[model samples]
Target: MRIILIGFMGVGKTVVGKSLAKNLSIKFIDMDNEIEKRENKIISDIFKESGEEYFRKLENDLLKELVKQDNIIISTGGGIITKQENIDILKQERKVVFLDANVWTIQKNVSKEINKRPLLKQSENIAETIDNLLKKRINKYNDTYNIKIDINDKNINEVVSEILVHIG
Candidate 1:
């Protein structure tokens, strides 16, 4: 089985994906991490130097490759839905799960790792920024996901278990 987790940043896609992969005894791939590994630079650095267009192209290319593999769980970056080609690719998948969370939940989750995020650095009010982004992306997420999981009140295990139940 191949499962792809998609949502806004700080929605716990990576954490939930890892647990799901572990329980299913499959490999877990964080798309951003994979891109960082391949480029030998962090995502923020990629955005800073090469720019977001470059990063998005790299992401698109990687998505094309990863979808061909089996027995893996892919946790995609938040902005993957921004590109039409990427959205098309995700729509083709059988198990694309959108892990949904509220603005306050997202702010709390991302605060610890704010330094790692490039987009958040562009904003002064994190909550308002997050809300705006969510508004823009929520429709795309709704259209792409086969399963929608509200992750606002769930732990990693709970999220994973819920995914397992749905995907099973």
Candidate 2:
């Protein structure tokens, strides 16, 4: 079984995916981390040096490679849904789980790790940025998910458990 976790950054895709992979006894592949490994640079640096378009193209190429494996759980980047091609590649034979978090929840979660997120790097108003970005990607998320799990106010353990129950 291949499961792909999709959502905005700081929505606990990495955390939940790790736990879920352990629970399911599958290998866990963090897309962003693999990208950094392959590119020899952090995601923020990729965005800074190469630009979003280049990073997105790289991410899509990597996603195509990652999805072909079996018995793995993938934690995808937040903006992966920006391109329909990414969505199509992700949904080919994987269960795409949308770890839904509202704008306010996203702000709260992202504020703690704002330094790591390239998109929110210079936003003075993180809440507004998250809200606006969510508005742009919400439809894309809705369009390609196999299941949706609202993770607002939920801890990482709880989120993993919820995904397990939903997927099973």
Candidate 3:
């Protein structure tokens, strides 16, 4: 089975995904890294050069290709669930886990990397951006995720434990 981790940029998807994959003895793939590798450019660069529309198209295509693999753990991009088609494609044959954290927590965790995120980089206020974006996408995240793990008061290990419990 493919265990897909979905959430905003700062919710520890990549770190948790790596730990979970190791614990489960499966390959772990971060969709954003995969895109950067394939395009030979960082995600921020992709957004700067080609625009988010183009990058989302690449992300959509990659997700379709990735679900064909077996026993993989996927850490999806923050906006992966923004499109209905993408959500439908993932739900076809995958277990999607949403990692939950408030906008304040997200901003705190992602402050160092805010420059790396295309959408947040354009915002005049990062906290406000995170809040607004989360408000807009929370419903979609809830609708698409099969399992939800609230990591607000949890460490990485704790978060992984919760995910394992739910997955099993």
Indicate the TM-score of model 3. 0.97
lDDT of candidate 2 over 1-168, digit per residue (tens): 999999998888998999999998999999999999999999999999999999999889989888878999999999999988998886675489999998888888777778899989899888888888989999999988988999998998888887778778
Error of 3 at 95 (Å): 1.5
lDDT of 3 at 95: 81
Model 1 global lDDT (CA atoms, 0 to 1): 0.95
lDDT of 3 by residue, 41-126 (tens): 99999999999899999999999998889899999999998888898986775489999999888988998887788888889989
Estimated TM-score per prediction?
A: 0.98, 0.96, 0.97
For all candidates in order, the CA lDDT equals: 0.95, 0.89, 0.91
User: How many Å off is the CA of 67 in candidate 3?
Assistant: 0.7
Compare the candidates by lDDT and give the number of the best one: 1
The C-alpha RMSD in Å for every predicted model, in order, reads 0.6, 1.1, 0.9
lDDT of 1 by residue, 53-167 (tens): 9999999999999999999999999999999999999999999999999999999999999889999987899999999999999999999999999998788988888898999
lDDT, residue 6, candidate 1? 97
Alpha-carbon runs more than 4 Å astray in model 1: none
Error of 2 at 38 (Å): 1.0
Better of 1 and 2 by TM-score: 1
In model 1, how large is the Cα lDDT of residue 125? 97
